[model samples]
Target: MNEAGDTGLAEVRVDVWLWAARFFKTRSLAKQAIVGGHVDVNGGGCKPAKTLRAGDRLRIARGEERLEVEVLALSERRGPASVAQALYRETDASRLARETARAERRMVGATAPPKRPDKQARRELRRLKDGG
Candidate 1:
């Protein structure tokens, strides 16, 4: 049992926690994300090896998706998705916002193909896009 009085909980590195929680595919990627400022621990910037305790807040980004979760438990091993879910509790608003953003981006991307024109348009678009 840990300080939180939960036998399932453990103390682990932030990167490992993120990986085990399924935030990133690998610990290295999680570290990269942390260094890239795409992952926030306890509402502030943290290193990959920062120690994470139960109830800590994490904001993680995967591509265009962002997630906010509260650490419910900690595990160092990469386990199954179901097991991973047991380690954290995602906020409802975060889930909804991520889904909506993903849908909106998908829709925009799908419709954006026609917006790109030929070579002439490319030159003009570049000028406009770059504010040149």
Candidate 2:
């Protein structure tokens, strides 16, 4: 058991880890996401209060993006981005997949809707159709 003298607990809560690691904006949001099945710990679904420790793998799905990271440290309090980053490490495959998805999105930007026929366009189409 990895005990933190302050909490006197072997590990930190999953939701607290998520929030502290910058995965969610708030602990409530992290709990909500966990309850909603947006997060998986060690290939299995976990609850907000699930105990988390170093070396655990997590799968977090946020919108269309999914991140798989290995927990490197545990913390209950939120910190700056640099400190938060030290809490976990994203796997290489996950990083490559995310970049590929981003590139695909950029290449397939929103398509323009088909042009509608206005008064002039309608008349022209009608004339063409009528062989005039």
Candidate with top TM-score is 2
Query: Any residue pairs clashing in model 2, and if so which?
Result: none
Residue-by-residue lDDT tens digits, candidate 2, 20-75: 88999999999999999999999999989999988899999999899999988888
lDDT of each: 0.83, 0.88
- By summed lDDT, which 10 consecutive residues of candidate 1 come out lowest? 1-10
TM-score to native of every candidate shown: 0.76, 0.78
Candidate 1 C-alpha RMSD relative to the actual structure: 7.7
